[model samples]
Target: MDPQHHDYTADPHLHASHPVEENKPSVWKKLGGGSLSISIIVHAILLAVGVVWIFQIIPATEQKVDFMPKGGGGGSPGVKEVSNKKQRATMTNPNTPRMAAKGVASTFTLPEPDAASSMSSVGSLSSGGLSGGLGGSGSGGGRGDGHGTGFGSGTGPGLGGGAGTMSPFGMVNPNANAMIGVFFDTKQDPKRKPTDMTPEKLRDVIKEFTNQGWNERSLENKYYKADQKLYQTRVYMPVMSANEAPKAFNCEKEVQPSRWLVIYRGDVVAPKSGKFRFVGAGDDVLAVRFNKKNIFDHGYTQGTTALYVPGKVDVLAGKKEDREVERIIRGGAMRVPVTLYKYDTTANWNNALGGVAVGPEFDVTAGSTYPIEILISEIPGGLFGAALMIQEEGATYQKASTGSPILPLFRTDGSLPDAKGKDNAPPFDSQGAVWKISPTSRRDI
Candidate 1:
């Protein structure tokens, strides 16, 4: 081989090219790539769950509920049933009278006026005749007669007696006194007269007393007279409170648990007849009758915690209770009967503290008065208090004045006087006939 022809293959510059190999990724790097998206999704889920949990822990707002006795229907007898649509429509009209359930009608016997005397006076005035002449007294011209020819001075209709002065038929003075009776019962006796457990007996007793023309004063002394065997008498008033009254008879015994019964009788006068709503708040059992028909009946197994003290634990820590009752009341005066019963066994607290507020919204006739009454009772326990409030339709809710009594003015004869023509008369009970407590005086627990 020639020396110049040394192998060109052996030269370093003449080599063939080779392809490059890719590097494999580590496990940590692969996982790190997807971590951001996974973290974001997990955080979002956690945030949503937190929001839902917050809502669950908070309590919901309280709502009004209808309460009825076990056997009673939605409304009492004589109350015409109307659709919700019709009832709502009627409520909007101020002039329409509410259709109240018929109860035992009250009978009032008024003395007849002497017609002969009135007619004779009218005849005499007519017989006197009139002397002509526009402004004169003598035979002619100038002012002569002592009486003016232009007008006659006659007494306007006697107060509350004239055509428009009295309440419409089936209505009574709203300011009239409510007869109230308080009884203590030991439910152990099933045959007990005026049994606190029997609603029918309670109604009968109310009717009998009303028919007998018993007033608040009269009922006060006769508390134990209803049933001396089963009932222990306490206090009676046009309006009453177990908390404020002095302890009486068997009720003073602390060891012997006793049931309570309270009866209230009066008239409710609507300024303008229309739909009215009634609301009650308190502990234990309460019922209301309008026109002698049961309109509101509330029975609760758990009782009420509206006035319960915060931080004070209760073994019967049940739900808070309340009721809303609606009724159609005729304009003018309506008979109203109210009953309150508290069973010592069922009540969580020893003392009952509660109230009834009627309509923050209701239509009423202008310049009309309404009669109101309240009866409250409680067994020996903590604090006791109660009140009844009337709210004008569309008005804001305000606490009623508790310092003074809400009572009606009376004539000298112990009868409710007509609102008309009685300007100077004093109230029958200076403190007022209605029951109410000042906010400061109320005892909650």
Candidate 2:
């Protein structure tokens, strides 16, 4: 028995244990044995496949993408491109007329055409032979015919005709008279009545007062003479308001608190002959005499008719009155005498007298002219004055008449003086005095 040469055929277990293995080549040995480029190519292909497989297995990251316009000019500078979906939704076929937009109607229908006979009568409408459209020109009694001129007339004076008759003409002078106001001072006596200071007494006192000389007087006589002397001497306008007496005579203090008198003398030239009305108002007494007749007299209690102060006495207490008298006169100038008297026994704040004689309704054929005089006096005076206005009867005093005075008579010093050298007379006729004129001669009818 040799140890090195053991019999293998005898042991089946030993043969099973030492089984033969096949000699497959290693990966590096096979790679080393192939051509370099071919091996490289094969390896690269394998690597590329492996990389692609690995990329597909892992999740890929997203990247941004920008789409460009077809023409390459880009979009309009300021305009934004609307989405294709919106454009398709709003688009209409060019060949077909669109009735409305997408949301308006699901289906469109065409309208039926009108029958030809419906418009066949259009040429028959016409306006008969009328002028200016609407109705004919001479329809409503107007002067014009459709083709001719209308009625046209000339202008005339007054309403319907050129002028009418029965209008007064010319104006008398307002400042024709020369007025003198003489003021006298009287003692204040509370017990004195208006009757106590009568016109007779005032006349007698005035005579004595004017006769008093400046010389030969005792101490007591000096006081009496001084007290009785005329306090003021001045010319006054014939027309005066009650309040104007003080300014006209310079006797504001003397007139209201004392006694006074005034005389106005003038010549009135009546423009024509007609009935005349003498109207007057006074606080005490008012009288008027024309053509030597006592035309008006309203003493404190002696007249049948009286105009009392509105609120003073309920039954004509005689404190104040407005009186009037009417008379007939011939044409031409004549004398007019006016007398105004006031007795301030009640110490009233208002003390004055005034009157106006609507001038005669003169006959157009008669001459025109007259005289005027006025005498105004006040006794126991608290306030006193008078005024007289003369206008034609039934004829309003015309601002344009020749006798009208344009400017006021008051001087710069508030004194009303008589007409100086030349008087500035106003035209007497106003618009109310309308006169008809002869169409031929153009003279007043």
Candidate 3:
């Protein structure tokens, strides 16, 4: 025992009070395993918090639903890739306003919107203005900005008055001034114009066409209707000998000159109560109807005097109308054979410039309105001319150089002299008496 004395001598007093611990795991180590234990603890705390929020707290408040569009995926929010047909914006008006019923009209074009409505409509642009009052917001509006898909900055295939705006009549000229000239496009139909048509055939065609296939009982119908022309203040186109064409009043270009027929119908007021007669002429054909009664019918053709004679219409002084009267030799009456507007009568078939025919007398009171119709036909499509002169019985007129009276020009408005005859007609005399137009006239009884 005394030889190995150092075995237990060193830490006897320290070990007596505190015992040495063993190399084993602690209780905290048993609870906290590793990083996995820490991760599990964190997830458990989060799940507990989430359960409290969903089941206990959230149930007491109003829930807001956020609906996501379904797609070809896992029922998540996404955009749908599909297509559908687009349609035009039709005209519609709200007659009965409700969630189910809205009065929809199909009229695409409207002159203007309804003023008697508090709401608006959707349609084509207006023509002029509304009949009721000013204008409301139609498809576009009355030349203003409007609401509802007038194809404003919305995304769709909606039609707005096309692109900008459209006129009512496409390409039409609704003008009003003097007489209305109804033009018949006879050249459009080959039967109306034949290949081998002569002056006689042309004359017959014109008569039949103007008569709506020649109803000899009367000469007015609604068979041949075409474009119209409203002559200026007066229709004093005395002649169209040089193939001058009538231009469109709206457009600047010349149109519809030859190979057509036109019937000028309007009211003409008598300036004075006297025995008045129509001294008219034409190259192919010229006929006048006063008060719906045929007054004169004559033309430069084979049978000039054999046309229909209606009412008091007759050959003036019972003489030939196709031949011009050689009145004098010089300036003085019954003195010299002075030529008036005719130097080479042979060039135009010895006619009075355009072929004169004095009609019968028709009594008209002053300031009275009477319907007058003048028809001029250009059948051959070559050179054409027409004129209308007036003569009052017992009224003395100054004689021309040819000793014939420089008669008054029958017209509805004022006259502007074309001395050089450049407008496809003979030079007119503005100084002569001019017949004027009247607005109101009684219909034929």
Candidate 4:
């Protein structure tokens, strides 16, 4: 057999005949029978490589990377960022207390921990006092270490140096001997006589006293002799407001005309030898009658009459003419006119001022100096008559007698006296007979 064709017949069992030319082998065809061993070796290598890839290599290639940098992020870790809304809420609603039911925002503004706690308490004080209380702590505390936030170094708002301690009204004049109180008594008791009062009947005395600047009413026995020029006292009844007419005693309801002003009448004395007579000549005498109810008998009497020494004195005699005979009196009788101070909504006159007198008139000024005169005289019908001369610098005077100088001066610019005709006279306590003088109209000389 030929060497190339020898196997074809020798393996007749494996092959039926020789292959056709169209099915002949390509260039990469098997060279010999040993090629089967080479194929077996290549397949075994690929199987081993696949086992290593699945079990070991893939897990090693995948990794997790960390991106966080060095220093702690955004200040201290737990420091909370306060919103503008929260800051404003704390400032505006500082007065409100904390409650569980309220929103978290509202509770934050309230005193921390507890709302009803006292600011002065040792625990709270050490922690930080309330907003307005004394020795308070820094506002917006625990925010920063004295940094951008305004609160720092243990200080509160408006608490730096030069802050004022006293209120505006607390500043008082050192030299001024101002009236701080007043007293009044209307009961007829001889032991209660006050010397400062002019000799006159006690009738209609409350009305007469109230005509002056005594805005208080019905003083107690203890205050009848208070030594101060004018005592500081509050009235039981509400007086008229500053804007209302000063002459009217606002007893809260109506201007009760029967109310009168009162002061410590110095030492009421009985006439010594000479009989108490009218100021005028014998025939021109005046008989005075006083209503006991209207009169405060603390230092005055209903029938008491001061001896009239009519010698062109500051007080003149009431003319014995057409109507009720009257006597004139000057404000010099009582040096400084008694003054009255009003109270705010809650004031106890008896507790604060000790006592008060009712019915004295006052000067009508918003906040101006007041010059008031009180007249003490006798009325023909046995009444003790009084008239008040309340003159305001720029405003109209209330209950001023006729010919009593009305001076209109500007308080702001310190303007000089600009009086015409009747007002030409120097401003003085030139009060005249007030008897038969109506509360409103009559202004007599």
Q: Write the per-residue lDDT of candidate 2 for residues 1-445, one digit (tens) a residue.
A: 8978989978789998997898999886687755776778999999999999999989864332222221111123322354565333332211122232334332433223211101111110112111011112121111111121211011111001111100010001111122222323333232221334444455444334322321122212312112211111111222223333333333344334334444332223333455554433333333343433344433231111222222423122233342322111111111123322221221121132221222222233224333233334444344343233333345444232223222221110111222223211111222221111112321110
The C-alpha local distance difference test score for the whole of candidate 1 amounts to 0.29
What TM-score would candidate 4 get against the native?
0.20
Write down the TM-score for model 1: 0.26
In angstroms, how far off is 257's CA in candidate 1? 6.3
Report lDDT per candidate: 0.29, 0.29, 0.42, 0.24
Stretches of model 3 off by over 4 angstroms after superposition: 1-177, 189-201, 208-225, 232-235, 238-258, 302-355, 421-434, 442-445
Superposed Cα deviation of residue 232, candidate 2 (Å): 16
**Displacement of the residue 31 alpha carbon in candidate 4, Å:** 99
lDDT of 1 at 298: 23
Q: What is the lDDT of residue 22 in candidate 1?
A: 75
Across residues 163-214, which tens digit of lDDT does each residue of candidate 3 receive?
Answer: 3221211111121224555554443342333244344555556555444422
Candidate 1 lDDT, 1-445, residue by residue in tens:
8878877567655443434477999887788857877899999999999999999999885432222211111233223343566544433331243232234244422222221111100111111111111121112111111122111111221111112111111111111122323343433243333424343343343334433433334444433322211110111121223322223222333212223444544444343445444433222333344444333322221111112222221211223222211121111112122222222221222233212222223344533444333233343323332222222234333222432223222111122323222211112232222222222322110
**Model 2 C-alpha lDDT versus the unseen true structure:** 0.29
For residues 1-445, could you state the per-residue lDDT of candidate 4 as single tens digits? 6776766555876576655467767555655546867888999999998998889855643232211111111212222353555534444433333333322233232212321221220111111111122222332222212211111212332111112111000111111111122223232222444434322434434334444433333334322321212211111112222211112111212221222233311111111112111110010111211121122111122112232323321122122221211222221121112222222211232223211212222222232222221222222322122211123333333323432233221111111111123211223222321111112321111
Which of candidates 1 and 3 is the stronger one according to lDDT?
A: 3
Off by over 4 Å in 2: 1-177, 184-247, 250-256, 298-369, 383-385, 391-445
TM-score of each: 0.26, 0.27, 0.45, 0.20
